[model samples]
Target chain A: MKIALFGNPNTGKSSMFNLLTGLRQQVSNFPGVTIEKRIGTFKIGDQKHQLTDFPGTYSIYPHSLDEEIVSQVVTNPTHEDFPELAIVVVDSSNLERNMLLFTQLYDLKIPLVLVLNMWDIAEKNGIKIDISALEFLFPGTPIITMNARIGLGKERLFAAISTTNKAQELSPFYDGFFPSPIEDKDAQKQEIQDRYEKLRTILPSIQGKKSSVKSTFSRKLDAIIIHRFWGYFIFSAVLLIIFQFIFAFATLPMDWIEHLFITLSAWLSGALPDGVLNNLLTQGILPGIAGVLMFIPQIALLFFFIALLEESGYLSRVVFIMDRLMRPFGLNGKSIVPLMSSVACAIPGIMATRTISDWKERLITIIIAPLMSCSARIPVYTLLIALVIPKTYVFGFISLQGLVLFALYSLGLVAALLLALVLKKFIRSKNNGFLIMEMPEYKKPRWSNIMISITEKIKVFVWDAGKVILAISIILWVLAAYGPSDSMSSKIRAIKETSLYIKSTEPQKETMIASAKLEGSFIGITGKYIEPIISPLGYDWKIGISLISSFAAREVFVGSLSTIHAVHDENERHENLQTHLKEARRSDGTPVYSLATGASLMVFYVFAMQCMATLAVVKKETKSWRWPFIQLVIMGIMAYVGALITYLILT
Target chain B: MIQEIAVVLLLILSLAYLCYRLNRKFFSSGKGCDTCAFSEKGKIEHLN
Candidate 1:
């Protein structure tokens, strides 16, 4: 049987769905709308039923696309997801306001079980409910009081569902709820107002008096949280702390992961015989996998903080505050959520753009969303920052490295906004964007919800991003391992016969021959071909190769560099990537990763569209290749120009 | 010699598999990446 769970926003309906379904839930979009449809299954007495959790709405008469979905599905019997039974979840504390939608559903004659969710909060606010009175008023309908956060009232809800009849019979209270269909719009409004008047008259019998003190407290808190001036300050402070915590907490784990991979690589090299298999395992696969795994600590921490903000309801206030600022840039406040989400990763951030109603604004948000430095760029930023920026402190407290990292994040934000301003001028839209978000009341964040979010996000990063990195790494290994058949062998032979090779120690001789062979390899030739294009940015062919390989993922740059350098420099096999990069030099005897080169590379990563996953998601989200292709060209040009300017100024 | 030949064949098979997976992920209309939070149903739903 198909059951539908419907409710007003902030009624704890999703929480109840989570409790009922646990991990059996599947998320998809409703037909013709980007609004998410979450379905789950629960069995009662060996009979399994599908429950569809519809997006929250205020009434059957819809104002927004999200609400239109609910209106269409419930009113249209021919719809595929038309429910046999409807579960109308209501916020118990605000029953008068909540009953607006319930009355409509009741009049529609859909068989329903009323759920008085957040019952504990209602009771604490001094509101009393006469359960038997409610039962008497609405005959044949079961009312289940629940605190969905902790899985309370599950047994009773199940018992009610198991025994309830499936017939669509309206309660006696709703007999005259709908006045006869009116032709005029104003008449329809008058009828709705009359229904509310009748509901008010009936409210006294079933509901006891509630205090206004609790609501007043919420208002007073919002006064400061959503204040024009203090709101921005608090939001900035919260963001600063989140970034600081990520850097502080993730360092130990990141260091451990780095150390573990280095040791494993060394062990594999010692144990395996020298051959193609050994090189693939030790040089190509292990380092690539390690490169992906090393970023998990930071990624997990970022999602943890975001989940906390969302669960606490502060994320909505940020939307409220940012909406005003974003309007002049052609975006509404809803764009803030996706932009903030992009800080963790752009794929989900782009997916989150479904919440935005305007097409032009949403497309613009998707185009500029990736410019926000995601966690994928963290590896590149950390490596480059460590190389160029000294680890000294400013004002006796702030780390210089931390400040530079903050500047990179700020640059992405500023650039996204500026680009949005420019795109606003070109993309025409007649729809005026408005924010209709519900400010969910502040509460202690649920730890279980936070953990689920963190685990899911980290899993997505590792598996999705991991596959791309691994494939690219293997391809890179092949390109670097072999060269033109005879030329590579002859190059190695000639290097060994040189006076320098003959006079050198055993270790130096091996290093020279390895380096000589690499210079003749396929990747080496490809890198050289692109050297002229990248030379203006202070990059050699080696850096050029990394830049090309990293188009699969920005983080892959580090792995490719490590793989390429490890191919030749066996003595530095176990050395950390940072140390190896520091020691890398061009053929002209200049350090390859000088301050100019490091800064240029970091600038390029900040602006470049280097992630295939992000590009794929944009294509999927916009339902066209046009936007993603345009995004590629725009970001690529910006990266090149920015890198050129940075390198020129620094040198 | 046998070991070398086996390793060569294994490498070829691995590369082929990698290429196939890459094409499926980035090019074809399937859920390109399983780990992406966006549902495959959502991506393919609108296309049809």
Candidate 2:
């Protein structure tokens, strides 16, 4: 059997799916969390069934692309995903609004088992739903009250599912409404009003309430949290504290991990015979993996705070307040969701634009979405900030490095807004976008869910990104290790003829030879080819090489630098990447990572479209090669010009 | 000599794997976002 779960947004529909299917699809305390259909399998008795959790929608009438997906699957019986039965999950505490979706689905004539999820919440709010009365009103429908959060009513749900084997010959809520498709907008509005009127008549008979009133905690908090000025202030303060904690709390673990990798690399280099394999492991693979793993503490910390804000329903308030700011930039409040999601990665963020109804707003959001700094940029940002920015505190407590990290994130946001203004002038749409979203009742953050989300995020970051980093590291190692015979021998001969090389000791000569070999290597030659173009932006050939390689993925920049530096400074085998970069110098003996160069490079990364994954997603979403090509050209120009201006100002 | 040849083979294999992944991520059409790092974690099954 194929069963489909449907409900209004934030109605615990996905929570019920997770309970039954034993899959951890992301269930947050906000709407539009499930932008894609999540499919999983579960067994009932001897029979196994596939269950799909669709994006939440309000009615059979589609408003946005996500809702259109639901309408298409349900209205067309011949569709492959058309379910044998449907589970209409509704919030029992707010039964009136939720029942609109149920009535619409009921008239579709599909077999459904009405699930009043969040039953405990209803009871706690002094509201009681008479199940037998609801059953009598919609005869042959098995009504089950459930608290899906804790699996309180799973057994009854299973029993109800088992009994609903066939569609009942129940009376339609509106007899003649369906046969003639209500094509006119006025007719659709009239039909919806009629349904609500009927629901009002039936609600008194089925619902009973106690003397105690519903809680107003969420309303009380919203007064301050969503206040025009204080809301922005509190949000900024919260972000500042989060960055502070990430740096302060993660330092010990990050240092330990860095130390461990360095010690391991050193031991391996000595323990093994000095050969090609030894060099491959110590110089290539270990450094790359180490560069990625050392930042695990920071990544985990960042996701930890994000999960809390999301699960506690605070993120919805951020979206609510940010809507006012977003409207002037050719975007509406709904654009905030995709923009916020892009902070984790832009691929899903672009996919989330399906929730936006206006074509122009959606297109504008997709174009500017990647400018939001993502987790992939975290390693790049943190590494450069540490290398250039002072670690001294500003207010006697705030770490300067953390403040710079926050500023880089804000820079991305500001750049995104500015570009959206420019794109808005070009793109045109007649329909105005409206954000009709629910303010889900705030609740305590669930620790178990937060831990699971963080673990899964870490796993994805390591495994998916690790594979690419390791592969590129190997190729880079091979390129840096050798060169053409003519080029290599000529460099070696030229270096040996110098008085400095002639007068140097044996160890010094070996170090000099290694440096000469790296400069003449294949990768070096390639980097030098682009050096002139990037030199005005304060980048050397080495930085140019990292810039080229990191196009595979933004995080690969750190790995590339680690591998390249490892090969260049063979004598400093025990030093970590940060120390190696700190001591690097130009041919003029000036510091390679001076403030001007570091700031310029960081600004470049802020504007660059470096992630191939993001490009692929934009291509898939827009269904045109033209948009992605334009995006690439626009961002490339932005990166070069932005970096050049920053270098000039700083120098 | 054997170790050097083995290292060289491994390098070639790595390059081949990268090429294959890049092609599949960009050119191939599929149900999911093929290049997305978070896709494996998200477990999205596009109904289309």
Top candidate by TM-score: 2
Which pairs clash in model 1?
A323-A333
- After superposition, the stretches of candidate 1 with alpha carbons farther than 4 Å from their true spots are A24-34, A61-72, A96-98, A129-138, A171-221, A490-504, B1-48
Computed on C-alpha atoms, the DockQ of candidate 2 is 0.46
lDDT of 2 by residue, A37-144 (tens): 888788889988788899998877777888888888888889998988899999887778788888877888889999998888788777888889898888878999
lDDT scores for all predictions?
0.76, 0.85
Which pairs in model 2 have colliding backbones?
none
C-alpha TM-score for every candidate: 0.88, 0.96
Residue A256 of model 2: what lDDT? Answer: 94
Docking class of 1: acceptable
What are the per-candidate TM-scores when only chain A is compared?
0.89, 0.97
Off by over 4 Å in 2: A179-184, A209-214, A503-507, B34-43
The iRMS of model 2 comes to 3.5
Model 1 TM-score is 0.88
